[model samples]
Target: MLLPIIKCGYELCKSENSENLIARAYPQLGKIFQRFAILQFFNDYGEFVLHDVDPNLLTFFRSCLSR
Candidate 1:
């Protein structure tokens, strides 16, 4: 899966809704995350002010991560 640059954040990744990518693409990884009781899969906010990316990308990533 192609991902956005470090400046853009995970929000811009191809699989932002990672609800089933591993299941469809890599079943082993999906099983690992599902079996782990404390596993947490989430997007992340990248360097906003310093990197060349969307202005709202950081905030959007943060909001999604917080959930």
Candidate 2:
């Protein structure tokens, strides 16, 4: 799911019409990439077993990306 989304984003970013499309799509694209990064961070660090990450931090990240 994430792979496809990232691929689409990359394709769009490479397109000739990217300037106009990306300008309008930046917010949505940012949210997708941010979520992917967060998920990847936990997956890479083996933090899920400890479950130590705070939910509030995720919420804060989402809020910041929304802007």
Candidate with maximal TM-score = 2
Residue-level lDDT for 59 in candidate 2: 72
The Cα RMSD of model 1 versus the native structure comes to 15.1
Which digits, one per residue and each the tens of the lDDT, describe model 2 over residues 1-67? 6678668876877775668777777787777677667766876885546775568457746675566
Query: By TM-score, how accurate is candidate 1?
Result: 0.19
Candidate 2 residue 8 C-alpha distance from true site, Å: 4.4
Angstrom error of the Cα, residue 64, model 1: value is 29
Model 1 accuracy (lDDT, Cα): 0.39
Residue pairs clashing in model 2 are: none
Model 1 agreement with the true structure over 1-67: per-residue lDDT tens digits? 2223222433433446665543464553343344332222122333323444454445444543454
